[model samples]
Target: MTPHATYPATQFRIARPTHQLDAVVAFYTEGLGLPLLYRFEAHAGYRGAMIGLPGVGHHLEFTEHDDGAPCPAPSKDNLLVLYFPGRQELDVISRRLEDHGVRPVAPENPYWEKKGLTFEDPDGWRVVLFEGSFGGGGRST
Candidate 1:
């Protein structure tokens, strides 16, 4: 008998601080093209928004900080790696981000054939857009 498989990695969320929730929502929705799934403003001044692809469990949640507590700035040591379905889409999204005033950093062309582009978000977090699997035919951008 074959063994049963269970539980695949489905979703993730990140927290960030911002005084401009509306602008941040616009960036994720209009600029990145992620659909707004939900927004909440609790009584204690807690606020958040969830953005994601339609029909997929994948999502990103941006939470606003209360008590005037400052959220730490993003560092180079921490990065969010995003994988697109293909290289073509990666290029398209990269261009879109640039058009929205978010310039992508230098792409990483690993010898293993994976290519990726990095960029910083409004809160200074590093987001890396990557495509392709490790080891195989490599193409130049």
Candidate 2:
């Protein structure tokens, strides 16, 4: 057999401008259930926080951009998609988000062979919770 190779994404980070860092933190930590990994004062009168997820080799870093620099508008350009191991986990996550008053943009269901839910962060960053393989007989174009 030939030698095998593996590639995995380590982490994801984004700089978000917000007038309410505390509220953002609460939304990400308490609302989304991601653990606050780190927080620090950034340059030019700003702050940031890194949130970690269990089992996934990825973490989300939120940075506060310079004040009065025109808070970046939300878009569908880039999104942060998270995958769970199964449907039960997906349901639990969706319920938690709802309990925290975060309405999911797209509720959970089996689509493209996976059960999942979709929503946007306070800063308009797209977040998703999916479970299943997007391969084999069922795939989306």
Candidate 3:
């Protein structure tokens, strides 16, 4: 089968359920320096936040069910990789995460160890801050 030359997804979000909504939001906003774009509370027994770089086409959504969100990270290798263009950004984010009491964890793969630093969120999901840009600058062409 062949792929479509151009698919049509105007915006994107990676959503996850978390029990610790506050810590999760802090991880993305304070630790990673992403802005909180939108948030809601007690809507259908849920509370959540969307965080990312403003004007970017994608963001992360973390939600909690009032009943209890027992979702856990599937594995250490499951990661949301963010590509950065320089080491300065990496250093700044690293310091911020450290100040927030979030320390980098060793990655499961050696390739990531060589190219980036990894950290786990409050719910154990891993996120990577790569030291260089991804193909086509991490944006869809």
Model 3 Cα lDDT, one tens digit per residue, 1-141:
334346667788889899899999999998899999999998999999999887888888999998997795579999998877788988889899999999999998868877689999888889888887655554311
Model 1: number of clashes? 0
Where model 2 places Cα greater than 4 Å from the true spot, the runs are 1-12, 55-57, 107-114, 133-141
TM-score of each: 0.72, 0.70, 0.89
Higher-TM-score candidate of 1 and 3:
3
Sorted by lDDT (best first), the order is 3, 1, 2
Note the residue pairs that clash in candidate 2: none
Candidate 1 CA-lDDT value = 0.70
lDDT (tens digit, per residue) of candidate 1 on 22-126:
777877777667799999987377788988878986778777756654767655546666667798998888888888898876533342124777776676666
Taking the tens digit of each residue's C-alpha lDDT, what string does model 2 give over 11-99?
55655667667777887888778899889896677688878777665676666765644657666535566667788987888888899
The CA lDDT of each predicted structure is 0.70, 0.68, 0.86
